[model samples]
Target: MRLSQSLIPTIKEVPSEAQIASHRLMLRAGLVRQTSAGIYAWLPAGLRLLNNIADIVREEQDAAGAQEVLMPTIQPATLWQESGRYEDYGKEMLRIKDRHERDMLYGPTNEEMITDLYRQSVKSYKELPQVAYQIQWKFRDEVRPRFGVMRGREFYMKDAYSFDIDYEGAFVTYRRMMLAYMRTFQRLGVKAIPMVADTGPIGGDLSHEFIILAPTGESQVFYDAAFEDVDYGAANFDSAKPDDLGRFFGIMTDNYAATEEKHDLDVWGKIDDSRKREGRGIEIGHIFYFGTKYSKAMNFAVTGPDGQKLFPEMGSYGIGVSRMAGALIEASHDEAGIIWPDSVAPFKAAILNLKQGDPTTDALCEDLYGKLRKVALYDDRSERAGVKFADADLMGHPWQIIIGPRGAANGLVELKRRATGEREELSLDAALAKIGLNAS
Candidate 1:
């Protein structure tokens, strides 16, 4: 993509309303714009990152045997009433009325609606273990939405609903999701620790909140330091039998980890000082096993092996897809701007034309840009060298390749890594190779 031809509306000064670094940087970098108090319109650059994150979530969900489905944003309130949660969900639910005066709402979550869907078609044990997921927009009228997308009233989320015949089946499904979440976060370059959490309005005894530690995070969390080094990918879930999965679950559950809402001072104090660690963390993902909560209320029943009708056990898993954009910025950024992870960066590298009018520099940048179509952003704008340098850093591409008349004359280009602030002078082919692109 060429900067001169793109719609990147970067600003020089931070917006006064942005209170956090990620919020400010996002505004200054032209990633997003606030349309209302907590609603935002994602610009082209921000949309690229959002799509990348959603793709990762989708991949992991599919790998875990979940089918993708789209659900409506506006749903009839009758569904919530059927589940007995219409009055219990409280004010955050955006209640509305259609022209005919029917109660309606923009769904804050989809438990009630998904239950109704399952009950309508899935009537037997043949479809006992099935998971359906969707990536869609959700709205919750947060009284005070702040921290940019991290706490936005309108945001994108990936929610998956699982149905099973009984507790044992539910456990199997939950373990599959746990393994999936680990892979999802790992692929996105985040170390998310799963801590026991209060289920809150969702109402469940078994729940885990995946948190990423950041200084600006909202909740306090406690866990063993050893969890920081544990890699879920090392455990092969694809080949693991039921017994192997049970053992994996035992290993994860045996560890001590809990959010502040569920923390026990006495139990936490039992751990040695070296093993204990406390920090502020952002909740990026949450999973819960609410057995028969929605199914029973909505009459979602299936025949058991013994020929008895039973309400299927249910569970829900959620990952904050839009909020992860801000969370990624919060967890990884420097004074200059965001330091995007390679997997989600909008562009792998920015090709800076230090002297746009110079024939040599122009030719070099154009050649490199043509060779690397999707992986590079060519800065062909007629701006000063310093201005281009600053914009490249602020945009947070993983690498920046600077070409000038002097460098081009000497058969060299300046290559810089955004995260490490390291620069090197190398031949054009050498620089492209270093950025993991084939110059040929």
Candidate 2:
């Protein structure tokens, strides 16, 4: 993508309304624009970043045997009414009336709707365990929505529901989802610690909130450093195996981790002093094992093996897809701008043409750009070297391929890593190799 041809409307001055680093950086870097209070229109670059995050979530869910399904943003109020939560959900539920004067709402969550879907088609213990998921937009009428996408009124979310025949089966699904969430967060280039959490309105006795540590995060958290040692890719546990999940679950819960609301000093005091980890954290994902809360309330049931009617135990898992964009920025940014994780960066690298039209410089950049055009953002604009540099840093591509006339003429390019501010001059082939490209 050429800068001159793209629609990135970067700003030099920070908007006064943006109170957080992610909010200010998002606007200044031209990732998104506010269309209304607590609502935003994601620009091309922002959309790419969002898609990348969603893709990771989808891949992990599929690996965990969760089938993807698209649910409607607008839901019938009857679903909530049947679940006995219509009046209980409060103002956050955007209740409305359609042309026929039927009560409807913009869904904040899909528990009731998913329960209705489950009971409609799934009829016996033969299909006991079914995990369905969707990545879609959700709306909640927050009274004071702020902090950019962090607390947005309308945002993208990935919600999954698991249906099982009994408590034992549901607990297994919950552990499996926990493992999936850990893998998902690690892949998204963030370490999220799972802490015991309240179920709140979702009504679950067992719940866990996945939080990523950041100075600007809303909740103060304390945990053991043992969480930092587990490598998701190398962790030898199978999501499909019950015993493996049980072992994994034990490992996760054995560690003392909690938000301020759930913090227990007695437990915290027992941890080794060297292993203590404490910081403010942002909640990126949550999982709940509500058993028969929705199924019982909505009177959804299937025939058991003994030919008796049985309410299927269920669990809910959610990840804030759009809010992750802000969370990622909050967790990983420097004074210059956002330091995007390589996995979710809009572009792999920026091709900054220090001398845009210089014959030698342009030749080198075009050659590199042509080879990596699919993954590269070419700064083809007729802007000053300093201006190009500033914008490149602001956008926070993982790498910057700087091609000045002096370096280009000598068949060399300066490669810089965004996170470390490290730069090196190398041959064109070496530069490409360093960026994980091979000369074909």
Which candidate should be chosen as best, given lDDT against the real structure? 2
Model 2: what TM-score? 0.97
How far in Å is the alpha carbon of 103 misplaced in model 2? Answer: 1.1
* Backbone clash numbers for all candidates listed: 0, 0
What candidate 2 gets wrong by more than 4 Å, as runs, is: 236-247
- Listed in order, each prediction's TM-score against the native is 0.96, 0.97
Off by over 4 Å in 1: 242-251
Candidate 1 C-alpha lDDT tens digits along 1-440? 89999888899998899999889989999899999999999998999999999999999899889999999999999999998889999999999999999999999999998898888889789877999999999999999999899889999999999999889999889988987898898889887888887788888789988998877778888888767666666666677466756555665577788878888999998999999988888899999999999888888889888889999999999999999999989889888888999999989999999998899888888888999868888999999999998998898999999999999888899999999999999998888778788968
Writing each residue's lDDT as its tens digit, candidate 2 over 114-206 gives: 999988999999987999999999999999999999999999999999999989889878888898899889999998899999888999799
lDDT of 1 at 87: 94
Error of 2 at 340 (Å): 0.7
